[model samples]
Structures are given as C-alpha cells and as structure tokens.
Target chain A: EAGVAQSPRYKIIEKRQSVAFWCNPISGHATLYWYQQILGQGPKLLIQFQNNGVVDDSQLPKDRFSAERLKGVDSTLKIQPAKLEDSAVYLCASSRSGLGDSPLHFGNGTRLTVT
Target chain B: GESVGLHLPTLSVQEGDNSIINCAYSNSASDYFIWYKQESGKGPQFIIDIRSNMDKRQGQRVTVLLNKTVKHLSLQIAATQPGDSAVYFCAEKSRDSNYQLIWGAGTKLIIKP
Candidate 1:
C-alpha cells in the first residue's frame, strides 16, 4: 500500500519553455486526477482520467496543457510554452472508487517554478 | 453554480485547544462535502466528510457538521496540535460520480505551542 508516486519533486524552468510531470497512482485505483495548486489557493482540477478514458478536462487549457493516461496505470501532464502563471504545484491524486468518501490519495506534488 | 469558500483565510490556535473552521457554500444541488488538510509542499489529505442528508459525521479526533439548510460546513478538531497546522479546505460535490468538486479558498491553520 504505497502512496501515489510522482517524479521530479521540484522543477524550475523559464517561461515559454515546455515542462511535463508524471504520476503513478495506487494499485487498483481507477480514478486519477491532475490538479494545479497555486500558492494560497486550493487545487484546481485540470483533468480527470477513469481508466485511460477522459472523464472531465473542461478546465484544462487546450492551447497549452495536455494529459494522457495510457493503459490506465500511469499519467503524464504536459504544459507547453509555460507561462509564469502556469508555475504552480501539479498534484496527482487517485481514489479506490470513483465516488463517495473514498478519499483521494495524493503525492508530494511537483512544484514548478517558472521564471 | 456553487462557490465553496471559507469564512476565514487563516486561523491560529493553541495546542490542546479545540479548533473549529467554517465554510459557506452557495450550491444547493451539492449533496456531498469533505474537509481536507494540506501541509506545506504536500497535497490535501482528507480529514472528514458529510452528506447533505446527514447533519453530522464524526471521526477520530475530528467531526464534520453539515448545515445544508444554511449551506454551511464546519470541521471540529478536539485537540489541536502542531501536526494539525495546515491549510484546510472544504469541497462540495453532487451525488453523481461524474460531478466535479467545488473547493473553498482554504484556511491556513497555525498552531501555537
């Protein structure tokens, strides 16, 4: 029962540069979500994946952000041409089931700092 | 359209004292609510949850009270500690599995030793 795992705990890049974050969810978990947490704000849902299928990504900026969960085990969120505003913690969470008080297990998150 | 938000942006409490954080929600359609605690450099961790049908739910050292009639939620911690020092957020969602969450702005809790 390991927790959700994420890569590159910290990242620093320049604005307009491309950056990508990876997430490996808990075993047997079907729902995976990517959220952006700006300083002093709650995490905003970017995209949600239910076993390789996109459930909701309405908040994802189609022009600059994209994510994929191939085969439904791991996921990657990419932010291209990153802007200063795009610099925030990218959190990856997973749940045992899709609904209820099942609770979302989160990783330490990748803190992206765009200069 | 519901906006989930906290009454305060930050709270400071002494160790061994109880802590009560408040939240106000605008969406009447939301039937589920949850409270999350987030520490620095980490993601939110679930503390407690309550459904609209139920007014209160209790957990170890924690309790969540839901007042759907007034669209409010509160998290009560019996004995606040240094470990409890983190930002708290209240999230609301519908019964449907696909419905997304509406999260509050969050309240930063500071514990005094």
Candidate 2:
C-alpha cells in the first residue's frame, strides 16, 4: 500500500511572504491531519479533517494559518505573511477512521524555512 | 494544562544492549497510548501501542508498558541496533479532548557500536 504523500520536500520563503503546502493521504483513509514540528520539538497539531469537514482546529493561528480538505482526499495548508517563528516542518497524516484505535500514517513532511 | 513529558532528553546505549525510554502523562483519563520513532528528515512511524486495560504489549523487538496508577508509559527495545537510533515519542489519546493524541517532547536514543 502506498503511504501518505506530501509535496515540495523543502521550501524557503521570506518573512511576511506567503507559502502553501500540499498533502495527499493514503487511499481509503477517512481522517487527515496537519501538524507543525519545530526543530528539536514534537509535532503540534494545527488542524484535523474528517472527510472534508474540520474536526478540530483550535490550535491553528486564525490570523495567519489556514487549511482545507475539499472533497476529503487531499489537503492544503497555507500560511500568509509568514513569520520567522513559522519555520518548521509541516507534516500530514492519515488514518483509516477518526474513531477507535486506528494508528496514524505520516508523510515525510515539508520543511519550510522562512528567512 | 495536561501534558506528556519524557524523563530524559537523550539516552546513549551500546549496541546489542537493551534500551528503555520512559514518559509521564498528567491526564489520568487517557486510555490509549502509542510509541513512534522519528529519524532525521522523516516523519514519526508507529512502533507499538497499548491500551490502558493492557499493561503490556509486544511488537517484534519492542515492548510497551503502561502504569495507570503512576501515569507512566515505557518503551523497551531489546538487543538494540544502530538502526534503532532515533527520537522516540509517546502520545496519549485523551478522553476529555475528543480523543486527540497529546504528544511528548521525545527522547533521542543514540546507539553506539
């Protein structure tokens, strides 16, 4: 089975610029998630989508970050007016189902470097 | 305010020796836990998991032990190899947080030959 796929293995942008990351989850997966992982730190949840509908996004910075999973198969996370602090790896993951004991499958991630 | 944390930030062990990494969680209501191994430039991969009802679960050469009373979770790697070197993280599924998995900072395991 193919794994979760993410694009632009690495990205570089200037501060106050905009950047976007793309993700295509595994086949038949019902839940997708976006996480931001800083160097030397664990991943922090940014948003979650269950079949194109948001399940949770309380941690997402409403002022600068936004994500959408239209049609429920693919997702995109965007950061406008990026800050230096936003430099981190953005990971995408998927699960068979949002409920129960389904383990998450993660992609290699998009490493964003904001100068 | 609930959080998960590791006892050590880094651990070094000689190759072929057993390795143990520990984590502590503040939420008592969390019932499901998972262990993930993350290498440089890669995302976290699931290693093993154990539900609160089961104190122990074994997968291949890895073992997960959970202590509900102490709110502790541990991962034991037997006969560790250089390939086992990576950052290990423990996450818990909180019942109160809509079953969202709360992650720990992670413990870097270094295996020496």
Candidate 3:
C-alpha cells in the first residue's frame, strides 16, 4: 500500500554543477518511469525502465542526463553540469503492467533549482 | 477564443458546485486519455481515464469525456469540495504500445467555502 518514494524533496544547485534524484517504485510493479515536469507544463518522459532494462529514453538529454534502474526496484536520474532549463521537478512513477488498464503511482518528486 | 488555457491561472468555486476542466490535444492518434490531479507540493494523482472507444467513463463523482473528433478532453467533478482543489492535467496515450502518455499544461483549481 506504500506509494512511490523519492528523496531530497527540494534541491538547489548552481549551473554546471552535478545533481541526482532517486526513486523507489511500488512493489511488484513491472514498469518504471522518470519524467520532467516544468512549471505550467505537463510532464515529459525522460526515460523508462522495465525490470532493469531500458524501454524508452528518446527525450533524455544524452549529453548530461542519465538514468539507471540497477535492481529493477529503485532508480536514479542524474544531470551532470546542470542547467537552468533543468530546474523542473523530476517525477518517478510505476504501474503494475506496461499496458492495459493500469494507472501510474507517483512519488512526491524532487524539485531542483539551478542558479 | 478557446486557447486550451484558462484566462486565469486559478479558479475559485463554491463548494457543491460542479467543476469542469478542459484540455486540448494536438495528436489525432492519441487514442487513450486520462485525467490526473496534483496537489500542492506533490506529484499527480490519477483521477479518471477514458479511451477512444468510449466517450465517457465515470468514477465515484468524477467523469472523463473524450472528443476525438475535436481533439478535446474534459474532466467533470460533481459536488466539488475543498479537497478537490489542485492542479488538473489531461494526458493522451498514442495508439502504439510505447506506453508514452503525453500531457497537457495543468489547470489549477481553487475551492472556496
């Protein structure tokens, strides 16, 4: 019954500095996702993982952004040399199945601010 | 005149009144739709969902209506309460099995006593 868990609810860093956010998905969920939500905009998918393997990461900024789901249970998204454009909230979610009627359970999210 | 955006960033409605939130999607292939509620300082929470097959789906006091022809989707909250106040967003899923859910800019709802 526990919801998705994320760490460091708030973070502030200077531009070019490195930062990372973490997520722990719901138990037994097969699908995990990381999204970037800007103020006044909908969330944009950054990367997706299915049991420690990647499913999609087309939108991810390969130059700086990277994500990993090592054990298939927890994930970490990192942005090296962070930029002002990366100040949006980072959200991690999970679903029982990758398709069908399953709804995503999200964590509180980490709010990153780059100066 | 319909900008797929509200004239104001926030809306205040009296309790017990009906609340309607609207969204416009650009992709015609977006066949699956959902509505999510996000409280202040928290991630979004799922409210209701509807597919291209059906025009409407009801859950508790919430209703989701999809108009594929106009590329519009709306969420209706009956007898709205203070607890219902939050940012509402509508998401669309492509027909492909990529599991990608595209989203709309959020609309913030404010409830008054």
Candidate 4:
C-alpha cells in the first residue's frame, strides 16, 4: 500500500513570512494528523482530523499555525507570520481508523526553516 | 500535563549486541503504548506496540515490555545491526484522550561496526 505523501521536502523562508505544507494520506485512511517536530525532539501533535471534521486541535498554535483536511483525504498545514521558532519539521500521519489500536503511517515530512 | 520521557538521549551499541531503550510516562490512564523508529530524513515507523493488559510483546527482532505499575516501557532489540541506527520514540494512548497518542522525546540509537 502507498504510504502517506507530503510535498515540498524542504522549505526556507524569512520570519514573518507565510508557508504552507501539503499532505496526502494513504488511501482509505479515515484519520489524519499534523505534527511539529523540533530538533532532537519528538513530534508534537498540532491537529487531528477525522474525515474532514476536526477531532482535536488543543495543542495547535492557533495564532500562527492552521491546518485543514478538506474532503477528508488531503491535508494542508499553514504557518503564517512564521517565527524563528517555527523552524522545524512538519509531519503528516494517517491511520486506518481513529478508534482502537490501529497504528499510524507517517510521511517523510516538510522541513521548514525560518530565518 | 502528562508527558513521556526517556532516560537516555543516545545509546551506542556494537553490531550483533542487544540493545534496550527505556521510557517513562506520567499518564497512568494510558493503556496503549507504541514504539517507533525514525531514520534521518524520514518519518517515524511503527516498530511494536503493547497494551496495559500484557506485560510483554515481541516482534521479529524487537520486544516491548510495559510496566503499568511504574509507568515504564522498554524496547529491546536483539542482535542490533547497522540498519537499526535511528531515533526511537515511545507514545501512549490514554483511554480518555479521544484516541490521541502522546509522544515522548526520542532516543538516538547508534550502531557501531
């Protein structure tokens, strides 16, 4: 089966600029997740979508980070007015279902660098 | 604010030796735990998982031991190889977290030839 796919393997932008990352989940997966990983750290969940409806966004920095999974298959994560601290890898993941013990499949991720 | 953490940030093991990585989680309610391996320039890949009901589970070359009483989880890799060099992460899913998995800071595994 095809794994989750992400676009723009790497990105570089100045602080205060805007950037967006795209992701395509595996076929038939019903749940999508966005995560931010800082250097030498684990991935932090930014948002979660269950078939286009948001299931969680408690950890997302709403002021600067936004994500949407329209049509329940593809997702886009955007960072507006990107701060120097926003430089990190943005990852996208999907699972067979949002319930139960299903494992998640992840994409390589978009490495964003803010200068 | 529950969190997961590892005792070591990095571990170096000679090829063909066994490796064990330890993790401690603060959420007692978490019942499901998973181990992930992430190579450089790639995303995390699921390695093995264990539930609170089971104390241990084994995969082809990996083992996951969960100690619910102490909130500790360990991943053991047998006959470590160069391909095993990567960052390992532990994540937990609490019954009340709406299926969200809480991740811990990863441990870098280095394989010595």
Candidate 5:
C-alpha cells in the first residue's frame, strides 16, 4: 500500500509570511495526526483527528496555526505570519483503528524554513 | 534528519554484532510500547511493539523487552547490518490519554563495517 503522501517536500519562506501543507493519509485510516519536529527533538503532537472531528489540539498554536481534516481523508496544516521558531518539519501520520496500540503510518514530512 | 544542536546520542556497533538500544519511558501507566526506526529524510517506520502484559516480543532480527517495574524498554538487534543504521525511538501509550503515544528523543545507530 502507498504510504501517506505529502506535497512540496521543502519550502522556504520569509518571516511573517503564510504557508500551507497538504497531506493524504492511507486509505481506510480513521485517525490522522499532525506533528511538529524541531531538530534534535522528538515529534510534538500538534493535533489529532478521528475521522473528520478533532480529538486533540491542546498543543496547537491557535494564534498562528490551524489545521483541518475534511471529508475524513485529506488534511491541511496552515501557518500564518510564520515565525523563525515555526521552521521545522511538519509530519502527518495515520492509524487504522485510532485506538489501542495500533501502529502509526507516517509521511516523509514537509520541511519548512522561515527566514 | 538535520540537527541544529550537538549531535544526537549515537551507538556504534560492528557489523554482524548484536546491538542493544535502551530507552526509559516517563509514564508508569503506559501499557503499550512501540519501537520505531527512521532513516535520514524519511519518516519513522515501525520496528516492533510490546504490551505491558508481556515482557518480551520478537520480530525478524529485532526483539523488544519491556520492564514495567522500571518503566524501561530495550530493542535488541541480532547480527546488526549496515542497513540497520538509523535513529531509533521508543514510544508509549496509556489509557489515561486514550492511548496517545508519548515519544522519547531518539538514539542514532551507526554500523561499522
């Protein structure tokens, strides 16, 4: 089966600019997640979606970051007025059951650089 | 894939030797554990998983050992190969968070030929 697909493997933008990333999870996956990974650190959960409804977004920077998983298939993450601190890899993952210990399938990720 | 700080923790082993990577999880209530391997420029790939009910589980040349008492987990690779070189991370999930996984920083594995 094809892994999660992400577009624009790399992106470079100036500070205060806005950017958006696209992700398509595996077929039949009910849970989708967005994570932010800085260099030398572990991936941090930005948001989690069960089907089309959000289950968790406590860690998300609501002031600048917003994400949505529409139709329970494709998802998008947006960052407005990007800051240098926002420069990091944006990862998208999905799981079959979205419950229990189901293994997560991850995409290569979209690398964002804020200048 | 890229690091801005000091290099990540590294464990180098000779080819054909057994390799052991250790991790300490934070939550005692975590019952499900998973080991993921990630190569440069790629996303993490699942290696093996072990539930708290069991102490050990093996897959291919990899084995995962869980110690609930100490909140520790280890991944053992037999006859490690160059292809096994990558960053390994351990993640844990607990019912309190609806089984959402909490990840550890990762260990970089280097194989010496």
Candidate 6:
C-alpha cells in the first residue's frame, strides 16, 4: 500500500515571501491533517479536514495560514508573508477514522526554511 | 491547557539492551495514546498505541504501558537496535477537541554500538 505523498521535500524562502506546500494522502483515507513541527518540538496541528470539509482549524493562523482539501484526496497548505518563525517541518497525515479507529500515516514532510 | 511531555529529552542506551521512554499527560479525559518514532529528517511513524482501558499493549518488540490514574505512558523497546535511534513522541487524543491528538516535545533516543 502506498503511504501519504508530499511535494517539495525541502523549501527555502525569505521573510515576507509566500510559500505553499502540497500533500496527497493515502487512498481511501477520509481524515487529512496538516501539522507544523518546529525544531526540537513536537508537531502542532494547523488544520484538519474530513472528506473535503474542515473538521478543525482552531489552531490555524487565520491571518496568513490557510489550507484546503478540495477533492478529499489531496490538500494544500499555504503561508503568505512568511516570517522567521514559520521555519519548520510541514507534515501531512491521514487516517481512516476520526481518532482511535486507526493509526495516522504521515509523509516525510516538507522542511521549510525562512530566512 | 492539556499537554503531553516527556520526562527526559534524551536517552542513551547500548545496542542489544532494553530501552524505556516515559511521558506524562495532563488530560484526564484522554482515552487514546500513541507512540511515534521520527528520524532526523522524517515525520513521525506510528510505533504502537494503547487505549485508556488497557494497561499494556505489545507489538513485535515494542510495548506500551498506560497508567490512567497517574496519567503516565511508557514505551519499551526490547533488544534495541541502531535502527531504533530516533526521536520518540507520545500523543494523546483530546476528548474536547474532536479527537485531535496532542503531542509531546519528544525524546531523542541514541543507540550506542
């Protein structure tokens, strides 16, 4: 079985610039998530989607960060006017169920470096 | 305000020895827990999971022990190998957050040859 797939394994951008990362989740998975993981820290949930609809995005930065799962199979996370603090690994994960029903499959992640 | 954190930031163990990583969670309502292993440049990979009802769960050479009363979780890797060297994180499913998993800072496990 294929795992979650992500694009642009690594990215570098200057402060004030915009950056976007894409994710393609595992087949048949209904739950897709985007997380931001800083160095030496655990991942922080940015947004979550279930079947093309947002399930939760309370932690997302509405001012500059936005995510969408148009077809319920692929997702994209964008950050405009990137800041130095935005440098982190962007991880995409998918699960078959909401919570405990199954484990989340994660992609390798896109390492973003904002200078 | 609920958070999950590890007792140690790093654990060093010789290869072939057993290793134990500990975590503490503050949410009493969290009913599901997961252990994840992440390499230097990779995302977290699921190791094992245990429910609040189960005191312990085992998979292959990994064992997850959950203490609901104390809100403590531990992951045991038997006969630890070099491949086990990575950052280990424990996450708990939040009951108030629509089943969102809250993560810990993670513990880096270093294996000595």
Clashing pairs in 1: none
Best by TM-score: 2
Q: For model 1, how does the per-residue alpha-carbon lDDT over B1-113 read when each residue is reduced to its tens digit?
A: 55899999989999999999999998888888889999988888878878778999999999999887898899999999899999999998876535577789999999999
Ten-residue stretch with the least lDDT total in model 1 chain B: B93-102
lDDT of 6 by residue, B64-108 (tens): 999988999999999999999999999988667578888999999
Question: What tens digits encode model 4's per-residue C-alpha lDDT throughout B21-93?
Answer: 9999998888889999999999999999988889999999999999988989999999999999999999988
Winner on TM-score (2 vs 5): 2
Question: In each prediction, how many residue pairs overlap at the backbone (N, C-alpha, C within less than 3 A)?
Answer: 0, 0, 0, 0, 0, 0
Provide DockQ values for all models, in the order shown. Answer: 0.65, 0.73, 0.64, 0.77, 0.68, 0.74
What TM-score, computed on C-alpha atoms, does each candidate reach? 0.95, 0.98, 0.90, 0.96, 0.94, 0.97
TM for candidate 3 is 0.90
Location of the lowest summed lDDT over 10 successive residues in candidate 1 chain A: A96-105
Model 1: TM-score for chain B: 0.94
Q: Model 4 segments beyond 4 Å from truth?
A: none
Task: Please provide, for model 3 over A21-101, each residue's C-alpha lDDT reduced to its tens digit, 9 standing for 90 to 100.
Answer: 999999999899999998877788899898999989999999999999998899999999899989999999999877745
lDDT measured at residue B105 in model 1 versus the true structure, 0 to 100 = 95
Q: Tell me candidate 6's TM-score on chain B.
A: 0.98
- Candidate 3, residue B10: Cα displacement in angstroms equals 4.1
Best by DockQ: 4
Model 5: per-residue lDDT, tens digit, B1-113? 21111123789999999999988766777778888898888888889998889999999999999887867789999999999999988887888777777888889999999
How displaced is residue B76 in candidate 3, in Å?
Answer: 0.9
- Give lDDT tens digits, candidate 6, residues A1-115: 9999998999999999999999999899999999999989988889989899998899999899999998888999999989999999999999997766467889999999999
